[model samples]
Target: MRLIIISGLSGSGKSVALNTLEDTGFDCIDNLPVDLLGAFGRHITELGEDAANQRYAVGIDARNQPEALARFPSILDGLRELGIHCEIVFLDADDQTLLTRFSETRRRHPLSDRDTSLSEAIQRERLLLEPLHERADLTVDTTRTTVHQLRDLVRERMVRAPFELSLSFESFGYKHGLPPDADFVFDARCLPNPHWEPELRQLTGRDEPVQAYLDQQPAIAEYFEQVRTFLANWIPSFQRENRSYLTVAIGCTGGQHRSVYLAERLGEHFRAERGPISIRHRELV
Candidate 1:
């Protein structure tokens, strides 16, 4: 059986992720207590061969007792011993982002009460959930992610072929801060600036004019080739290690042009020789 444990901060889109998984045919349970995780796994195991092919996902959070939360690692080990393919997906966002979300929705934080302020509760929750965060197979930062984007990402990462790896290339602007979930980040800021040319200033890397402009730069070709070759050599190592996803981020002064171009180029080159490949332009979104 395939079991996924989703745990994260309250406003980090864990509900969206669980709903997406449920929509994709997973048997999802929300707010499952940590202490019952082992029993749940065993119960599923006893369901026999018919249940072996089923997919299960559960949400775990800081609402459980601190002692029980600390025992999560052992409980997870016991479940794996029962022959379950278990994976944890942890989501988080910066404090300011979480605070903004809570403020916008006018919702109370789960750990907050009359005695505790929202900021204090957020930090407390983070401390309480640190054990699970440490053991998570994937850590997703949703600071700049939208609800729709989060859903698509969850579906792409968890609903795909179990044995295949999903690769993604993301383009962002340095001024907007780095992508929190990127496994590898490359800087394209040193490349020639198309923004200086009035004709190409208004166009993006996806546009033919900007593409033509960038295609003429020798440095761009060299950078693309080097990055492509490096990933080509290392991708197999990750596959052998049974990694489910790999994110490569490229950044420039502004994400509209250079970074987007390299990301698209890399995605195109690798799509022909890989499993599942996705390209994301963060700023353009």
Candidate 2:
């Protein structure tokens, strides 16, 4: 049987993930106590082949006793010993984002008390959940994501068949910030700057004009080839290690031209060779 453990900070969209999994035909149980995990797995196992074939998603959170949470890793190890295919999907957002969500929704923080401030509760939650985070097979940062976007991402990336790695290529501007979920980051600032050319300044890498300009540069081609070669050589290792997702970020000074162009190129190249690949331009509308 396939088991997905959904755990995350309180406001990081764990409910959304569980709901998505439920919609995708997973037997989902929210706020399942950590101690019951093994018994639940065994119960499902006894349900026979048809029941075993149905995916199971259980939501776990910081609300569990600290001792139970700490024992989670061992519990998971035991599940694997029983021949269950288990994967953990951890969802997280920055403190500020969580705070904002609470404020906007007028919802009390789960870990907060009369004396503990919201920020303090958030910090405490993070500390308590560190062990689970460290052991997660996939960690998603939902700081800037909307409800719909988070749903889409979880559905696309986490609901796949076991051991299928979903690859994502993200383009971003270094001036903005690094993507928190990127497994590997490549700098493209040294490449030719399309922002310098008066005509190409306004055009993006996705444009034919910018593509034509970048295509003429030998350095751009060389960089693409090198990055492609590196990923080709190493991606199988990640898959063999049973990684469920890989995010590759390419960044330049501005995300408009060079980064966007290269990310699209890499995404296209890999999508043809690899099974599932997605591209996103962070700074682009």
Q: Largest TM-score belongs to which candidate?
A: 1
User: Over the stretch 1-285, how does candidate 1's per-residue lDDT look in tens digits?
Assistant: 789999999999999999999999999999999989999999999999988889999999989999999999999999989998888899999999999999999999999999999999999999999999988877888887899998988876788766477788999999999987788999999999899999989889999999998999999999999999899999899989878678899999989999999999999888887746788888886
lDDT of 2 by residue, 174-282 (tens): 9988888789999999999989999989989899999999999999999999999999999999989977789999999978899999999999999899766778787
Per-residue lDDT, model 2, residue 51, is 75
TM-score of candidate 1 versus the correct structure, residues matched by position: 0.94
| Segments in model 1 whose C-alpha atoms lie over 4 Å from true places | none
Q: Residue 277 in candidate 2 has what lDDT?
A: 77
Lowest lDDT 10-mer window, candidate 1?
156-165
Top-scoring candidate (lDDT): 1
Assess each prediction's global lDDT (C-alpha) against the native. 0.91, 0.90
Candidate 2: worst-modelled 10 consecutive residues by lDDT:
45-54
The TM-score between candidate 2 and the true structure equals 0.93
State each candidate's clash count: 0, 0
